[model samples]
Target chain A: MQAKRVTFPNKVLPYLLLAPQLAVTAVFFLWPAGEALLGALYAEDAFGLSRQFVGLENFAALARDPAYLEAVGVTFLFSGAVAGLSLALGLLLALAAEKAGRLAGLYRTLLIWPYAVAPAVAAILFWFMFDPNVGVAARALRGLGVTWNHFLDGRQALLLVVLAAAWKQVSYNLLFFYAGLRAIPRPLIEAAALDGAGPVRRFTAIVFPLLAPTTVFLVVVNVTYAFFDTFGIIHATTGGGPGRATTTLVYKVFKDGFEGLDLGSSSAQSVVLLAIVAALTVLQFRHIERKVQY
Target chain B: MARRDGMVERDGALTLAAHGVLILGVAVMVLPVYLAFVASTHPGADFLGGRIGVLPGPDGPANYAALVGLGAPPPGVPPIGPMLWNSFVMALGIAVGKIAISLLSAFAVSYFRFPFRVTAFWLIFITLMLPVEVRILPTYKVVADLALLNTPGGLILPLIASATATFLFRQVFMTIPDEMTEAARMDGAGPMRFFWHILLPLSRTNIAALFVILFIYGWNQYLWPLMVTTEASHATIVTSIQRLAATANQEAPVWHLVMGTAILALLPPVAVILAMQRLFVDGLTETEK
Candidate 1:
């Protein structure tokens, strides 16, 4: 955060150092974004070569389109559910593992293994786990004579998506939360107990407050992952399927860009999605990240 | 230690239930993979027959061998081994290139008093915000323009140079006392020498952390690779498996083969995490100064 007077050697050196990164970013990131914005404004035919500007047209289409509306609804539900559930589960597990004392590290290690698996592969794994015909759940449920159908029910599909998302996230959050919990002075909890405060009361007054900042940061990261990264999971598993029950915003983006090849409309969707995420991130930085404390 | 009114009983019950749930939670997390393992060892019939139990089957060796040896080609697609190899090579190439570039850039920024360091750092930082999806199409064109599509460069070029690694290594470097840097510089160590001998050794664990994460990121890659590569020959393990599943319209995918391929891709990153378990833990556990 401090300023150092930079020499031309320093000046050119950092640029030279940063040049490849900048080119990659520009080509891969900035260019696509700018093109997406432009694509949003202009209609493009197949082959992505032909184009014509149609101001606000794609946005209008997306606004009124049934698929887009449903995608928006599902996106909100998915992000909200995944974010909240993962936080609660992560915090609960972090508390459990942290309290295990000497075994905390090992427990944490094994517990978070799910997070280390690739997202697409994990989705595939869950697909097998949740498959109505072949899944462990299905087989075991039938073994107990309790029948379940995840494919038919919209809620079931969304629930599985949320669970899958949370499964990956809980481990990730536990990493941070366990560290946060470990940082809490044992003397404080000891003093709370010494003062006759019960576990629940002590957590409510002290431990929860101490854990707040970590929760806030995790919320931001979890929500971001929900928005962007976990789409592959949903794409692989539900495919915004069972009548588009699980399609999120990113799912729609993929549908538009790759599947539909409606670059203009998809680019518009991307712009809107990017705008929403950016604004939320700015909110996190301005309000939450600031309020978070050690 | 502080036993008042059977305090162990009170806290102990909660801990008991918590461990119960935690153990259950871990199982719930791991069981599907367990299924994958079991399924991988059995024949396609047992899997498609919806047999969940791991009744001893003779398919394990056959399936793993077929997957590893290109034993026989499926009807529409090629054998699995070459496809898996393509993915393996791509992951390794991307991982190695990314590490080299990131280390050089991270080193230059952390140790040198070069100009525009802040600007250069921030520029790279911007890429972290603009993830691959945002830049994906433009990058597709960047590759296309360079005639890199279907080539490893198309995959490797856009994939290299992470902003996260730069930030992570910078965090590690910042931990080293300035006196050490001064001492090394005073020994007339030039920039590259100092970076190799002094800074690198001190931050091996941090580098390992970056290696583990980056390798997993590269190895698990799906979307971009799917887009960049249009042919089956170029498919990564993910793509090959997806194609395997997609074509099994009348019957389920050969479960053993698919899971075997998944496990193959699963091995490298899991190994990185398991082998570097201590370093990964310590890297994450190290206190921020």
Candidate 2:
């Protein structure tokens, strides 16, 4: 734990090694964040040349802009639903697999397969299923009775986006939750069972509290996942479609930047998104302090 | 934590219920992949049938052949097969590069003392919170400015220096006994040699686990590739698959074809998971999975 001697060369070695990565992150990430924050506060011309220092003009513009306001509302609902669903499904699966014994490994592997399938592929796969005419799901549902088309209806489109995203996260959630579950001390569980506690009770009281930190960390992560990572899928799958009903925050950012060609608004939204994430992350560290005893 | 008397009094029903839920979960998780595989086998006609065709279809060869239709056969610029190669190449490059750099940096930070060591490590972790979305325009500007657009360098470079690997490697390296390092040093092993020979090999399973995870991560990436590359030909396999969904219309997206392609994408990761299932499970128990 203690260094024998601290030489000047030794003092400089590690910093020298980390310089490349540190430099890249700073220039590409840190510098950009600072620049983007500046850009967000300023208005820009049509060609993306900044025109003036507008104070909080962009944030005010977002507050009053109908599309921006709606996007924020939709963002919360979509992200919340996805995070909650994935958490529930993932926890259920993890818990079950934990009790699967010798077959637990098999279940865990199988469960995490979807995560490895990648969001892009997952989007395509689900797109096929929800394909209007001959998509397998549409066909099967129509064959039995009910007909569903995500492309035409706004409500269905929103539902489809949530389903597609939430389903894709199941495996990733399972991977972490399964890891967290597996790490739980067996003795505690055994002791609980010996005391005649049922699985549900034991889970609620013992396992859940222990998993609070992981769950909280995942909540922050999952919220970020829903917010940021789903942009591509939403772009590829729904295209914010049927209407703008499915346009979440990042999707709106992409739309403004790439599709609408309004780099300024997109930059503004991106800045806002970053602020939200930073705040949540700070809250996570604070929460982690209380929960992550190990 | 809770009173379990009711469950014990009821005998083994709780166990049965637990297994039941577990089995059901396993089924749901595996269902899509199975469907994709089966759809890959069947002719385009009955691909959507309710009847579960567990066996491979006779058209497996034709489907795969159709997929990889090389040269002038498919009558297009290219088919789906090449994208898989691109995905693999990109994923492998990113995985290897990220692993090597992170390990070296982590080794430096953990074993050797230097000014700002803690600060440097913290700076790396800052990226973990800063998802690619936050700095999309900046990174896009950086990549586009460098003219790295549509190249492997463009796709892979942005992810090469990851905080996750550094963070994980630091944690792993911190666990190594310093006594071993001192012993190696006493025997005339210099810092570089000691790190290369001893510490690296000692963390074999950790490295392997990370490599597999990273490989999957790269293979499945979408947004970054989509942003960097303009050419469909240059697209990674996942990109191509996503492009297919985008281009396809209201009709169920040629479910059979899309799912078949998905099956192709799933193969490498599934194979990795299957091959390294034991190591992964062990890694989970001993470290963070």
Docking class of 2: acceptable
Q: What CAPRI-style quality would you assign to candidate 1?
A: acceptable
Please give the lDDT score at residue B264 for candidate 2: 81
Lowest summed-lDDT stretch of 10 residues in model 1 chain B?
Answer: B1-10
Candidate 2 C-alpha lDDT tens digits along B78-99: 4776788899999999889888
Q: What is the DockQ of each candidate?
A: 0.40, 0.42
Candidate number achieving the greatest lDDT relative to the actual structure: 2
Q: Count clashing pairs, candidate 1.
A: 4
Model 2, A164-217: lDDT tens digits are: 788778877777787788678777877788897876898898999988777887
TM-score of chain A of each: 0.90, 0.89
> What's candidate 1's DockQ score?
0.40
DockQ of candidate 2 (2 decimals):
0.42
